[model samples]
Every structure is written in structure tokens, then in C-alpha cells.
Target: MFRLAHISDIHLGPLPRLTPRELASKRITGYINWHRNRRKRLFGNILESLVDDIKSAAPDHLAITGDLVNLGARAEMDAVAGWLANVGEPDFVSVVPGNHDAYVPGSFKLACRAWRPYMLGDDKPASSAGENLFPYLRVRDNVALIGVSTAHATPPFMASGVFDRRQARLLRTILRQAADDGLFRVIMIHHPPVRGATQSYKRMLGIGRFSKVLKEAGAELVLHGHTHLETLYRLPGRSGDVPVVCVPSASEAPGGHRPASGYNMLTISGGPGEWNCRLERHGLDAQSSKFELFHSEDL
Candidate 1:
């Protein structure tokens, strides 16, 4: 069996002091929001404990869906690169950017450059990691992992994601090829593609195009972040419902609308025709900081 661990929305904190120019754009709002709210709720110590737990679990591979930083600052991106390394090596960790990772115009590209090592596919060279190469494919054992970026800059107070025509085309092609290879395909995106997964201001655009692509080319699983809530939504596929799943922010403190930060552990056995998966959810306990299993189910 192959074990894949999923986590997202780290929102690594203690924001670096921003230059006036940096705050001139959309970051001003994020800065204020962080100071007033996130700073208190999102803690680095909590995140550290969570990472330790993940390492102890020793999943075969780790998939980080995105939002590793609070602001799309160069410093934040730089720090996140180091953080990712601490979590695992590039080859063992697969990542895609989230809405916050690309918080402002040009930030997404910057993040692609900084986090390139984690984002690269097996076919791409180290130098190619900086480009906007979406739908990157990496085959590991019986699993075919595809990284899709829904991360793009948006106006202030808007945390929406986009699934453009170019990405859609690339994704459809990748899905079909992976299916033909008979590998258990897992599509990693920053936003949940299912409708009503999030509120209007934070909704992911291009749902129609995305669903159409999925219906045309079936996939085994879809993983995402950004909602900061553990959720399961099934979307229509040619054979059966495709599972779209997410977990809360990796840095979110216990309580509130968002549950405590956690990671999804998916164990896959068998193959294409009769793939079996057991999902084990682990996270912070409401009354204590100890990491423990919160939910388990077969999918």
C-alpha cells in the first residue's frame, strides 16, 4: 500500500515588516487582517507540532495543496521554501499554490520560482520549476500525481481562484493519459472544484469548465485546500462519484467555523479496476494541543 499525506494553508506567520511599497497593493488589507485576527489564531508552534506528527506517521509521500504564507511577500516565499524542506525533500513532497500564495499580481509567479523544487514534475528540469507549468505530472509507484495551480492574484478582500482555459486543456490531457496508464490519478489543486464548497467572495471560478473536463476524463481523486475546513464532496464522473476532499488550515488554532489544523492520510491499495482507499484524519484536539486521529473512513 502507498500512503499519501495531504496538508494545506500553513499561513506561516510573524509577518516580516513590510515596506511601504509592498503594502501599496493588495497586501495592505492582508496585513491589517493578519494583525487583527490571524496573528492570534494562527500559531507557528502549533504548526511545528503538526509537522512533527506528520514525520512520525511517515507516509510514503506528502502532498501540500497550498497557502504556505499569509502574504505573497518575497520574504514569505523565501521562508516557505525552507519550511517545505524541513517537512520533506522535493522528490517526496508534491505541492501546488493556493489563493494566498498568489495574494497579489505577480506573486504567483514569484512563488512558483521560490517553491519550484516542490512543484516540479519528474519530466521537468530544475530550471523549469519557475515557469507557469500547470498540470505537472509525477508518477510514483501506482499513483500518478498531477499538480494544478488555481492560484492567481485577485482584488482585495477577494480570495478566489481561477481554472483558466490553458490549465483546463493541460489538465484534461494529463488526466486522460494518466487514466490510460492505469495509475490511480490524484489531481492536486488549491481550491475545491465542487460548487458551494466556499462562500462567494472566496469561490473558485471555472467550475463549469473544470467539471466538464472531469466528466470527459475521469480521475481517481481530487485534493485541495483554501476552505480551512475538513469536507467531502462527490462530483459526477463517467463511472462513479469522484471524491473531492480538503482539510483545515495547517496553522489554524482549534475552534470556530474552521476545525483545528490537520492532515488527511490516504492509504491506497489494489489498482485501477478495484482501487481501495482508507482515509485517516489527524489533527489538534480541541482541549489539548496533542495530535491525534479525529476521523476515519473508506473511500
Candidate 2:
């Protein structure tokens, strides 16, 4: 079986410090709340617990969907890299940048500079630019992992992301190639493929076009973050079915009666056309020292 752990939005600590550009862009309604609650030790504790959980689970690979930083600050990226290093193997962990990771104009550059050692593999470059922001692809014995960067620094009140025409085209080509190679293609990004009817303008502005591309190319699964909520949606393709799973923030404060933070473990088995997915949820506990299995999705 190919076991993979999916986690997202672990806004790591030493929080609330913003760049001049980021501070200016905080006029949005939700921005203040994110800053106020995101800086606490609670987030760090939750992250620590998550690392423990991942170590215990011991998945063959780990995929983090993004938002590792609160405001794209250099210190925050450094902190996130340190936290990931403490967790386990860095090469097994693949990540894409979220909107928060690109709060400033050159935020990606800063992230690359700070997190290069962990992000780069033996075959991959230490840093990528422009359309190659998420240029890494791993084809293991049982899984094909594809990561894409959907982070873009937008105007205040507009939390938008664009893969750009070049990246979109390359992604389609990659998907087609992966399908042809008979691999279980898993696409990872920071934005959802379908933003729902109540979608905010600030959330994945070009998802429609993005979805169209994916539908045409085809993939077994697409994982994303940035919604800060748990959601599952199915997208039909001509060749087969694709399931898109969105995970909540791994360290966000619980809202209403909902669990604050959680992650998904996907087990892939069988072969080619007979592959199956089993998704299990792990929630943060009171001590924030471990994650307990809260629920399991029907297989």
C-alpha cells in the first residue's frame, strides 16, 4: 500500500510580525482576526502535536498543502523550516505555497532562501521561479506526486491566486504524461478545484478555468488547502473519477463547535484501475501533544 499523509495550513509560530507591504494589506475583514489568533503558542503546540502524529503514522510520504507562514515574513519561513526539520525526513515532505506565504511581492524568494535545504531534493533545484514555482514531481514505486504553486500576492481584500497560463499548460502536460505512465496522479495545491456556490471572490479567482484543465487532463486525486475548513468534492472526468480533498488549518483555533485542527491520511492500494483510497482524520487533543483519530471516511 502507498500510505500518504495530507496536512495543510500549519501557520507556524513567532507570529504576527508583518512586512511593511503585508501590514498595509491587512485592512481586510478577516485579516485582523487571522493575525490576532494565529500568533499564540496554541499554534505551536498544535504543530508539535502534528509532528508527533506524523512520526507515529510513519507514512511513506507527506504532503503539506501550504500557508506555512502567516504573513510571508522571513522569520516565519525560517521557523516553519525549523519545525519541519524537527518533525522527520524533509525529502519525504512536499509543500506548495499558499496565499499567506506570498503576502509580499518577493515572498516566494524569501521562502526559497530560508527553506531551500528542506525543499530541494537531490535532483531538484534549490529554488525555482515564475512558472516553475512548484516544479517538483516524485514518481515512487506506488504513487506519483505532483505539486503546483497557486500563491499570488493580491491587493488588499482580494485573496487571489493564479497558476499562470504557462504553469497551467505545463500542468496539463504533466497530468497527461502521468496518466499515460499508469501512475496514480496526485495533484497538490493551495486552492480548491471547485470553490462552491458561496465562494468568495478572494478565493481562487480562476478555479473555473483551472478545473476545466484538470477535467481534461485527468488525475486520481487533487489535494488542497487555504479554505480553513474540511471539505470533499468529486469531479468527473472522461477517463475516470477524481476526488478533491480540502483539509482545514492544522493549527487554527476551533470555531463554533467544530474541531480546530486536523489532517488526512490516504492509503492507496490495489493496482492501476483498481486503486482505492481510505481517508482517516486525526484531531488535535487538549494537551496538544498528540493527534487522535477522530473519524474515517468511507472507503
Candidate 3:
């Protein structure tokens, strides 16, 4: 079996001291929000413990869905780069950006610069502007991991995502190619694909576009984050229902709403058309600081 571990919304804390000029734009709003809400909600040490648990399991590959930093600052991205290094190398890890990772104008570009290794596909080389890297594909064993970017700068009080027509067209092509190879297609995006997954302000814009593509192209599985809650949603596919699984914030404290640092361990086997998969949810116990199985099911 090919083991894949998925985690998201790490929201690494202890924001680096920033110059007033640094926080002058949209970042200031994130700054206040981080201090007022997220700082208390996120736990850094607990994140390390969770990562350790994942490493102990020794999954063949790790997929992080995003929100690796608070402010999307250069320093924060740099810090997260170090953290990603400890998690695993590019060949062993894949990542997609979240709304927070693109908190302000140009933040996404900065993330592309810092987290390129984890985000770029083997066939797609880096561009000077770092703009067109999304929808990248990395094949591992019999699984094809396609990372899509929904992250973009939004207005204040809005935590939305956008997957434009360009990206959707690209995703459909990848899905087809991967399926042709008899690979288990797994799509990793930072935002939930369907509507009503979150409040209107935080919802993914143009979700209909995504749904249309998925309905036509089909995929074996879809994985996402951004709600900070554990959720499961199945969308229509050509052959059958596709399993969409969401992992809660990987650094969330234990007291908040579904506030458990957790991840999904997906065990996939079987040949191309007859893929057998089981998902096991593991969470860090508050008292023990160790991972415990909370849920498991076949996909």
C-alpha cells in the first residue's frame, strides 16, 4: 500500500517582529487578527508533536494543504521554509497554498519563491515571476497528486479563494492524463470545492466552474482545508462519487471548535481501476500530546 499523510492550516505562530511599514497594508488587518484570535487558537509546540507522530508513521508521502504562516511576511515564509525542511524534502512532500498564505498583494508570489520545492511539479520548472505554478502534478507509486492553488489576495474581512478558468482547464487535463495512466488521482486544494462549505465571505468563488470540470473529468479523491474543521463531502464523478476529505487545523488548540491538531492517513492499494483506499483520522490527545485514532473509513 502507498501511505499518504495529509495536514493543513498549520498557521505557525510567534509572528516575527515586523516594521510598521511592513504591516502598513492588508497585513495590518492580519496582524490584529492574529494577535486577537489566531495566536491563542494556534499551538506551535503541539504542531511539532503532531509532525513527530506523522513521521513515526512514516508515510510514503506527506501533503500539506497550507496556511503555513500568519502574516505571509518574508520572515514568516522563511521560518516556514525551515519547518518544511524538517517535515520532508520536495520528493517526499507536496503542498498547496491557502488564503492566509496569500494574505496581501504579492504574498502568493512570495510564497512561490519560498516554498517552491514543495509546491512545484517535477515537470514544471520555476519562473522568474513564480505565477503559474499551480495545478502541478507529482506522481508517487500508483498515486498522482495534483496540487491546485485557490489562494489569492482578498479584501478585508474576506477569506475567499479563486480557481480561475485557466487553472480549471489545466486541472481537467491533468486529471485525464493521470487517469489514463491508471493512477489514483488525488487533488489537493486549500479551499473546499463545493458551495456552502463556509460562510459567504469565506466561500470559494466560482465553485460552479470547479464542479463542472470535476463532473466531466472525474477524480478518485479530493483533499482540502480552510474551514479549520474536520469535514467530508462527496462530489459527483464520471464513475461514482469522489471522496472529499478535509483536515482540521494542524496547530489548533484543543478547546476551540473541533480544535484538535490532526491529519488524515490514507492507505491506498490495488491497481488503477480497482483502487482500494482507507482513510484514518489521527488527532493529538490533549492530555497525552500523542496521536490517537479518532475515525477510520473506506473510500
Candidate 4:
């Protein structure tokens, strides 16, 4: 079986001090929010423990669905680069950006440049420049991981995402190609594809277009992280329903309406029309102060 570990919304904390010039734009709102709220809940120690737990499982590949930083600062990206190194090399890991990763203008480009290794397409030639756009594909074993970017800078108090027409068209092409190869297609995005996954202000803007492409192109599974809650939604596919799974923020402390830090372990085996898969949900246990298995289900 091919084991894949998925985690999202790490929201790494202890944000670096922002200069006066740095706080002169959209980042100012994020900075204030982080200091007043997120700093206390998204603990670094919790994130450290969660990563250690994931490493112990030793999945063949890791999928991190973004929010690796608080304010999308240069220092935050740099810090996450080292953290990504500790998690695994680019070949063993795949990532997609989230709304927080693109907190302001230009920050999204900066993140893409810094985290290129984990986001580039696998089919690119050796001499090809590594600047592949979104809707990149990485083939490993019998699985095709199709990643799309929905992250974009938004105004104050808004955490929305956008997947433009260009990305939607390219994603449809990639999905069909993967299907033709008889591979287990797994679509990864930072925002949930299903409606009502988040509040109106934080909703994905082009989700209707995304869903239209998915229904036509089809996929075996869809993985996302944005709501900071554990959720499951099934969407229409060519032959049947496609499973869409979302996990809580990877660094959320226990208590409150939001659940604790958690991740999804997906095991895929068999082949073609007879595929077999399993999902294991792991989360921090506040009473035990360690990560533990919360549930397991077949998909």
C-alpha cells in the first residue's frame, strides 16, 4: 500500500517582530489578529509534537496543505523552510499554499519561490526551469497527486481563496491525464471544494467552477484544509461519489469549539477499478499530552 500523510493549517507561531514599514499594508490586520488571538491558540510546542508524531508513522509521502506562517513574512517563510527540511525532502513531500500564506500582495510569490521544491511538477524535464505554475502533477507509485493553488491576498478580515479560470482549465486537463494512466487521482487544494465549508467571508470564490471541472474530470479523493475542523464531504464524480476530507488546524491547542491538532493518514492499495483505501485520523490527546488515534474508517 502507498501511505500518504496529510496535515494542514500549521499556523507556525512566535511571529517575528514586524517593522513599521511592514505593517503599512494588509499585513497590518493579520499582525494584529495574530497577536490578539492566534498567538495564544496556535502553539509552537503543539506543532512540534504533532510533527514528531507524524514522523514516527513514516508515511511514504507527506502532504501539507498550507498556513505554514502567520503573517507571510520573510522570516516566517524562512523558518518554515527549515521546518520543511526537518519534515522531509521535497521529493517525499508535497505542499499547496493557503490563504494565510498569501496574507498580502507579493507574499504569495515569495512563498511559491521559497517552497518551490515541494510544489513543482514531477514530469518536468531535467533542464526545465523549476517555475511550474499551479495545477502541477507529481506521480508516485500508482497515485497521481494533482495540486492546485487557491491562495490569494485579501482585504482586512477576509480569508478567502481564488482558483481562476486558467487554473481550473489546467486542472481539468491534469485530472483527465491521470485517469487515462489508470492512476489513483488525489486532488489537493488549500480550500475546501464543498460549499458551506466555511463562513461567507472566508469561502472559496471559484468553487462552483472547481466543482464543475471535478464532476466532469473526476477523481478518487479530494483533500483539503482550511476550516480548522474535521469534516467529510462527498462530491459527484463520473461514476460515483468522490471523498473530500478536511482536518483541523495542525497546531490548534485543545479546548474551544475547534478540535485539537490532528492529521489524516491515507492508505491506498489494489489497482484500477478495484481500489482499496483506508483513512486513519490522529490527533493530540490533551489528557495524555501526546498524539493518539481518534478513529479509522474505510474509504
For each of the candidates, give the backbone clash count.
Answer: 0, 0, 0, 0
* Cα lDDT for residue 28, candidate 4: 83
lDDT of each: 0.89, 0.73, 0.89, 0.88
Tell me the spans in candidate 3 whose CA falls farther than 4 Å from its real position. none
Q: In candidate 1, what are the lDDT values of residues 216-254, reduced to their tens digit? A: 988889999999988998888757888998988998887
Give the TM-score of each candidate. Answer: 0.97, 0.88, 0.97, 0.96
The TM-score of predicted model 4 comes to: 0.96
With a 3 Å backbone cut-off (N, CA, C), the pairs that clash in candidate 1 are: none
Model 3, residue 108: C-alpha shift (Å): 0.5
TM-score, prediction 3: 0.97
Candidate 4 clash figure, as a count: 0
95-144, model 3: which lDDT tens digit per residue? 99999899888888899999998988868866633558888999998899
Q: Candidate 1: minimum summed lDDT over ten consecutive residues — where?
A: 124-133
lDDT of 1: 0.89
- Report the C-alpha lDDT of model 4 over 1-299, residue by residue, as the tens digit: 89999999988778888888889988888888887888878888888898889889999999988788888888888888888998899999999999988998878888887788888888754433222558889999999998888889999899999988998888899999888899999999988888988898889999899889988999999999999888889999876889999999999999867999999999999998888889999989999989999899988
